[model samples]
Target: MPDDARLLSHPFDDDKLREECGIFGVIGVVDAAQFVALGLHALQHRGQEAGGIVTYAPEVGFASARRFGYVRDSFTKASVIETLPGSLGIGHVRYSTAGSKGQTQIRDVQPLFAEFAMGGCAIAHNGNITNAVALKRELIERGSIFQSSSDTECIIHLMARSIQSNIPERIKDALRRVEGAFSIVAMTRSKLIGVRDPLGVRPLMLGRVGDGFALASETCAFDIIGAEFLREVEPGEMVIITADGVESFFPFERQRPRFCVFEHVYFSRPDSVIGGKSVYETRRRIGVELAREAPVEADLVCPVPDSGTPAAIGYSQESGIPYAMGIIRNQYVGRTFIEPAEHIRNMGVRLKLNVNRALIRGKRIVLVDDSVVRGTTSRKIKEMILDAGAREVHFRIASPPTQWPCFYGVDTPEKDKLLASTMSEEQMRAHLGVDSLRFVSLDGLYRAAGEENGRDDARPQYCDACFSGDYPVSPADMIERGFQLKRSA
Candidate 1:
């Protein structure tokens, strides 16, 4: 949903950046849609707007179900899963970065299927297409009709126009004309396919389940269905999974890989692994780095709950400050809860998190959080802590300030909407009305992610563009729409 409409949805999570989608697929597995549903449930945190599953079986042909809500809400029922029985299936949990945003319609839900000259294929995409508007215009002029507003539909139209002899070749042909990040899970009757863009701006993992195979946005999804963690689907690489086994190919011209760094700080489930590193360990290391960079005199280190808990533990362990859950999250305050009046709406974060007044009162508290985007939540949280009679509040952010909007897939506010874009660290501290505020440096973040030398400006390792404004791939659509890039230093 858009920022304004978030008040009606989940206002507690609005200040944070959100990844747009999560995809999972399985091949050579009986009841693949059921496996896909479990995978999507594990990945629900990445996207909660809607979910869809498409499966192909010889007897039933193709079956699809897309519903506007959680996977648990829609795909769990026997009525829905029975209709989608197949040995090859693909599914998506969506949070709309490329399409209609908050206005997600059933048509926008994915596992978008189409029949082509070769046969029928369905795709579940997990990233954004930067040149979609231009390609969409060209395709429309060339007589390609679009259904949903999703940029991923452009790939379908492009594949339709391609003269390629097969679906995989047509996929490569279509991707060659498109720009930006993508980690796709697509399925034909006999084949389940996975591919990542040249930069690998998003994550996709390959897993093994007995003799069959799985592709997921994270290893946590693999964990949910008892699949063995294999390796990541490499950047610029494609894997075709069938009854025989898996065949790998590099369909795109390889560039220096720039996987999204924010996945470690947020987005991915803590239990997930990326590039052989545990997301939880990376976040803990981030806290270690943050404590080393910015230590403060606080009685207790407290996490903002859930997202900040691991980092807070690391901070406490490193700083010798006892860790406590100062703010308790209401585990059941779902997005469906309605605050019908202005006053009720104003009680924003209070609805989701309440300060542990007994633990917080009279303490000089250190509140650790993943990142501060607009600082609205930070301000509200600080107020709550102060009202609980805390003497002072210090904030330690896991990631560096988000200074730019993400074009590759993450749903972020415009540059100006980012508090860090217009304010210095000290200014943000003043704005949040905290005793002090510090964010992990970009290099510090890189070090925590296993880069010993930290970020290499000459040849950077990962995508920290949200913090640094150094986009690995030019965002073609935004540039065309008149969004300015950061001037070189």
Candidate 2:
């Protein structure tokens, strides 16, 4: 195991921390690596920090190329893409939640490789593994060597030790041993396997292209490859694609599906379908419900930016208020801004979003946003609206309050930093200096999902832990253990 000292320090600057990871795998194709590269390009919105691809051609065992920047920067050149050749492949686009800024160099880009008694395995993962620290300790004690600090690497070690007869069985054994949210795509000599946790905390979908099969974190990837939308990979299920064809395995007894609700509200592309509901439709319905639940007399409805635009339209339609582009976002600014000093860091928000005074001047405005994580950005936006000559600014959140931290892939703040965790709605309203503040109710959020009981086919229940504080997995003891480990370090 390598000493990963950078993990102790915060690496990401404030501006570049808003995206999730994406994974793609393909089997039984002539140019699988090239096709996977194209698929990753389409799903680039999910992650932008780093990108890589690993392919196993008949002549070549496992040829891999990875870089510390965007997918286009890494593999778009003719020289880079043409070099990779394989019929089985896996790819990853990463946004670091594990290693620090120093570790974010190329060494951290994944499809982490490990060789064992059974041969070799390459894994690309899209979600966080909560029990990783504990698991890594156990593996290290057993003499397993680790190349990276990423939690994804933990699964490779687990698979190497399992007594299963084949790769799929070994993978199933490894999954049963680990815990937390993970939507993984792993490739071996002859197989491409996709696995999802029992709670289904992250989204993973299956698609078919001609005679081949594909697996990705979102359907948007499928759109790029012209693959027909097959159904989602069921929670706790593992599907293995080989030359023989596709085979499904349910290694663990089934558990309730706790699909991450945030995916529909914020993370996923609006055009994608998650847990059977269209992301766009769900956000629109959230707007409709927010208008019904928190109606206010306002001259116009203005969205915070890209993610809030759909819900703002819905709010306008349901409330009979006109929708206007009151705020414009500078799309060219790449997720991070250049700040020479600590005093100027807050200015990043201004560079990202601005108020169009002509549309908002002298009017009562209804401001819509997807979620308020820390409330700092929300507070700033409200003040900007007030300064733009708005008579009043009433804030409407499209989703239920996020009161709990997510142990899954979403890098949510600690419980103490969450605004809703400590303060009442009235307290939060005063803190933000808004004329009024209201959030969509939990029941209303489910209803807006348009499912009879919020269960769409496979997932009969939703993961409302952030709003309800009823986690599917026990986090009380885990949090204490994590804290103790941090103190020891």
Candidate 3:
């Protein structure tokens, strides 16, 4: 949004899913914007491209600061934070799902604002609305002038046309017509509000940061600000918080929840809890499940580092292979999933990762990683390991092969671009040049996530559409555009 890409940092491609966004909101606090900043900082892994905060004060009114950079850089500046003064506020950290359609990229930064006939409200949203393009076209046909190309902006346009008398009622009126995943944080003059989609495909939690109430995309934000973890905002629930306390409503037809399974596998912070389970514990157990389902002999179990560390530890403990750091990640390297220009992606793994030849030489090694989207990273790593004199290199992926692209907000490669979409497991192993490659079974993934009896096909406990192609919500936009929306056989 700020046009800083001219600095020539890098382009992107990651062997993992691209995260969408993080949102934080607070009311009943003296420095509401600052608290929101801390919460967004804790949730930074969710989105990192740009951030904005909007606050309201009776003495001043609604004020906002949106910038294209890290939270610490944008929201932490005394000059920036001072401009936004209020006791109730909301904030958002965004990753560009893709490019916007117009020149108002600066306006696209959120917590997006709108002035209603009743009053003005500012909102920040996570997850994609599948019917956004259709809704936007319909809105424009009715003469709605739009400021941003974001799907979230569609919600604002719909709100402007609502006949409702109150902001919350108007919000409900607006959301009723949209479909797909959403977890929103909004600030009216005096209240902070939170909402989760009917299916709860994304995570949003309620907490108490003091006498004041708080809401965030993850519990890690509550931990960061010393808030007490309350509970999740249930599927289809809307919450409005004020000094009076919290009010809840069921604004949509209730359905069996389908929380995103990939959040437990890779997206969420290890310290955060989702649906009563620790993300780190879930990932670690996934590794244990992999060891049980796909046992292999190896000199040492080694992780790709950081995201792969917990699972590798579990694999080593379960299989009795000592774990080692066979690869070192440059901690300073920006996340690869955010880049897309082909030249930078083709530059490969050497930019962000390096092989620890001393740990890998002459020994059979098992490499534990979270997921493999294109097989490029895996192939590159295989070459590096072989060149380093490793006798045998086996790969153990913590999640099932991601054969289908996600339409629920994750920036997955297209179906045709997904390696698993076209290759058999044996074929993938050969292509990556690995002696063997194993992925945790889908049912095993369920077991790891605390579903004791494994997945319930009658009503699966999680959203695993990327693996099973069982989309709970119809991807209407993709379908209308003729992407042939059909489930995998």
Candidate 4:
């Protein structure tokens, strides 16, 4: 039951940049759909708008259910999972990025299914195809009918028209023609396939459960389902898993991996591991780096809460400043910003966070946070702190200023909307009405992420394109179509 009329994930939260999608797949298990449901639930943080699961069973063939809402609500019902009886399954959790046309369309919700020349296949994609518009035009010219307004559908059309001899070969042919970040999981009647693009801009990890193989966007999914974490699906590599075993192929030429750095800053479960580094550990290290780079003599160090907690702990430990929960988030107030009334929306930060005036009053505070986009959140937070009688407020950001908009997957605001893109540090400080604002340097971030040698100017280890405008994958569609990049990105 795909729901095209489903609502957005609190439009007010659009300011928070989000990962495009999350995928989970499992092969060689009875009730595989259950595993997929649990895995998708664990990955709910990555996407909150919609969830779908596609399962294949000898008795039932392929059964799918896509619904708008949380995975726990959409896929956890016994009646729903019972309908998807299968021994092989793949699931997708999706959140639309900004400019995502027809965002509520159920047809765009995936693991999009298709019947190709090779066989029947269902695909779930985790990254944007930068050249999708161009390829879509070419495919349309050659008479391919597109069912959904999604770039992931382009691969389905490409695979259908390929002259390749097998399903895997056709998939390779399709992937080769695509550009930008992608971590895909697809299922055929008897096989499960996982692929990561050459640069590995997105994350895809392999795992094992009992006698089965699993694939997921994050290790946290594997954790929820009690699976053993295996190595990551390597850059430019694909693994085809059948009942007998798994076979590997590297159809695309390999390149230096430029995994998204923001994954550590805000995405991914804190307990999860990426490239062997603990996400929580990296955040703490980032706080340590921030303390070293910008030491402030403040009465207390307070994190912005939730996303900022781990880094705040690190900053407190490294700088010897006691950390206090000066502002507490009301977990129950999930989407207070959704109030359509202007006065309610104007309430803003107070709706979600309440100032602990007892802890904050008369305190000189160092507020630790992840990143500043439009500075609206920071400005609101600063006003809240001052209203609580804070003597001074200094802002310490964990990552470098976000200047470039993320085209690969994140829903970042355009260049002109980004405060850092237009304002200098001093200007931003005055704009946020803070005594001072300091963002961790790019090299500091690399170091916290375990790039001990610092960033290699010629061959960077990670994609800091949001902070540094060095995009590894060319934004072919956006550039060729004249998507007005700042200073010719």
Candidate 5:
């Protein structure tokens, strides 16, 4: 594993759910690493800490580049791309959800590679494997030497130990032993492969790029590389692509799909599509549903900026209030802005966001934001709004209150640290010093995501454990470590 060379996350970024990773792969495209880089760039919002790419050409064989920073910073340079020349390639952008958090090692970065008895293979994975600890312990006891602390590395070891003769077959043999969510984009010497876990707790999509096929975490990535969207890799399904065409297989038991509901709320780009619906339209509908469920009279409807803009627009249109950009985001601010000095650290959200004082002064404001986790950022924003002479600040969240910690790859504060876990809506309002705080109900959220009759309590159509505390898959490792499941009613 590469040494911990220090990667800094934005100081204020701690208030939101941290996305796990983004992955992309191509098998038949010329300059395939370039396309993989472009696709990872499009999905950068999912993970920004580090990136890696692996490629294979008959002349060069398996070559890899993993670095601790943005993809644009490293992969864009010809010097770096030149080394990875091939027609088949895969890449990964990572944020630490399953391994070391603030301290990331270069080797911890992905497109993790290994050489098998059959051949060499590289894999990029999203989502957490719930039983990784037990699997790793067993692997170590059985004499499998470990390299990195990542859960994804366990998959490589599992594949190496498989009795299956072929790489794809070994993948099936390996995945069957793991639990929880995973959406993987992997490359064998001649093939590009994609797969989703049994429950479909995360997302993986297949697209067509010229004669070659592309696999990515979202449709937005396909759009970036001029790929035509084909369809989603169904839950429990594996897709193998070569020059000939694409082949699909179901390697796991079928179950009710449990696609992460939060993707519609925050993880995915608004322009992307999931479950055959536009993410932007779904967020807008969330605001519309919120207006009907919790209507408020205010002078202006304003968004917190960026993530909140689409929903604010919907709220304004539904409530007959004009929408305003009350908060301005500093477009140039990068996560690399390190605040080592106390005074600089104290600048906090002000460094990334500022109130449009002229537009905010003396107005009754309704502030729409995506989700509130620890309440630190919300309180800061509220203080900033009030300081700018806003008469009243009402908060409307686009998603249900996140009350439980996510074990399926999202980085979340512990359950006790989550504001919703410890406080009621009224208490949250008081804590943030806002006039009112309202979140879209879980049922309303489902309806916004196109569930006509709302969330089915009998059998949820999506994974909403962060809000509902009804985990679709048992968090086996957490249970062993004394993390209790939600109490039965």
Candidate 6:
């Protein structure tokens, strides 16, 4: 795994410290595969490494094509998109969390195929399965052959052996046995199914375009096709959309909603609305709260860029400070920029973001950023600002400190790798070499989210697992077990 602290060398890391996969499915469309391709293009920000689309026509059977590259690079020509012809399709964009070494190839591209007793099923999943290794072992013991090393493959295996006759029932049964965050879109010969785990740790929304129904990780994808923004797929709910129309089932007992808070703070596009709350507004509120909680007398307030822009605007509005773009990011730098040597990686930050010396010279600046995971990039950013002749630099974090690793889809590192997990606020301030540093309180974050005094059974509870160590699902020795087994073998 890459160093979590060093991940911020790339622009994508600044948007969200954690990485997540995106899944899109459409049913009842003339050019379903082409629509899925366009939808994945809109959601390319969610994941950039690999792209795949699976189409089912029933007469021609199921056809899948995928490539190991950005969606544009993978399928740019009209011919590539037109080749995947079907009325129902599912697409996926992936950023590997585990087994990313050799699996970066096209063979590992998703909408993985499984030939079951019923028929062929293709699945595209977002979020990690905490019990995948154990489940895979158990399934392998039962003589189930595996293909991909992705944790997502386990779900299909479980679905294949389910007692239910129909695909939807089988999927529902399989979901009941899984114990982690998963928002999945599956396509069989005749049906398309969408399911979210009981404790929704990821965002999944349903949309409509004409008579067709679409499901995507975020609403941003829906905007591309002018899909009507229907209500969110409920946590623990399974909705099957086919020629019969949309039908929902809650097969399992409901658990408390644990929607990933990082979605609003970082992962989601600013235009997206998750669980009835606007992501842009939520992040702006976090900035507002941060300013109120930790006010600083500064000459100017500057954002880290992109993700930090909204929060910086809010902070500037709340603090009566002038906001300026102190750091300019180079949009062209891709994932390859971070692959160089140490001195090159150090210089990579400058390539990605350059300080506007004129904006900061002799000014006391308050730097507003979303969150600081591993403090390496934060420390370097502060140094760059100081080097630009800023009189003083005070850092304000919009979200609370991330002290724990996320085992649910996100690529956060172990607890010890997190700067906040070990350092106190003052200690972090000293480490980053800033004049002062303060983080938003957990309560303040909830209050800003307008769920401070939320009822015990709210439908859209926030997932603060990274802030607080209260993980919705415990992955107990899974990480250790996998690493240990790999080492021993």
lDDT of each candidate versus the true structure: 0.91, 0.80, 0.87, 0.88, 0.90, 0.82
Clashing pairs in 3: 12-339, 12-340
Which residue runs of candidate 5 sit more than 4 Å off their true CA positions?
1-8, 98-102
TM-score, per-candidate, Cα-based: 0.98, 0.91, 0.94, 0.96, 0.97, 0.93
What is the model-wide C-alpha lDDT for candidate 2?
0.80
Task: Give the local distance difference test score of model 4.
Answer: 0.88
Best by TM-score: 1
Model 4 TM-score (2 dp): 0.96
Over all chains combined, what TM-score does candidate 1 have? 0.98
Best by lDDT: 1
Model 6: per-residue Cα lDDT over 123-230, one tens digit each: 988998888878888999999888777888787888888888877777777877788899999998878889998888888899998898999999999999878889
The digit string of per-residue lDDT tens for model 4 on 60-144 reads 7899999887887788899999999888999999876532334468888999999766668999999999999999999999999
Q: 72, model 5: CA deviation in Å?
A: 1.1
> Can you write out model 1's per-residue Cα lDDT over 323-412, one digit (the tens) per residue?
998999999887666646667677889999999999999999999999999899999999999999999999999999999999988888
- Per-residue lDDT over 369-421 for candidate 3, one digit per residue giving the tens place of the 0 to 100 score: 99998887789888988998999999999999999989887877778889999
Model 6, position 153: C-alpha lDDT score: 79
What is the C-alpha lDDT profile of model 2 across 221-312, one tens digit per residue? 89988888899999988998888888898877788788877787888889899867789989999999999999999999999888888899
lDDT of 6: 0.82
Lowest lDDT 10-mer window, candidate 1?
A: 96-105
Predictions: Cα RMSD each: 1.3, 4.5, 3.0, 2.9, 2.3, 4.1
Error at 406, model 3, angstroms = 0.7
* lDDT at residue 348 of model 6 (Cα atoms): 47
Give me the runs in candidate 1 sitting further than 4 Å from their true place: 97-102, 339-342
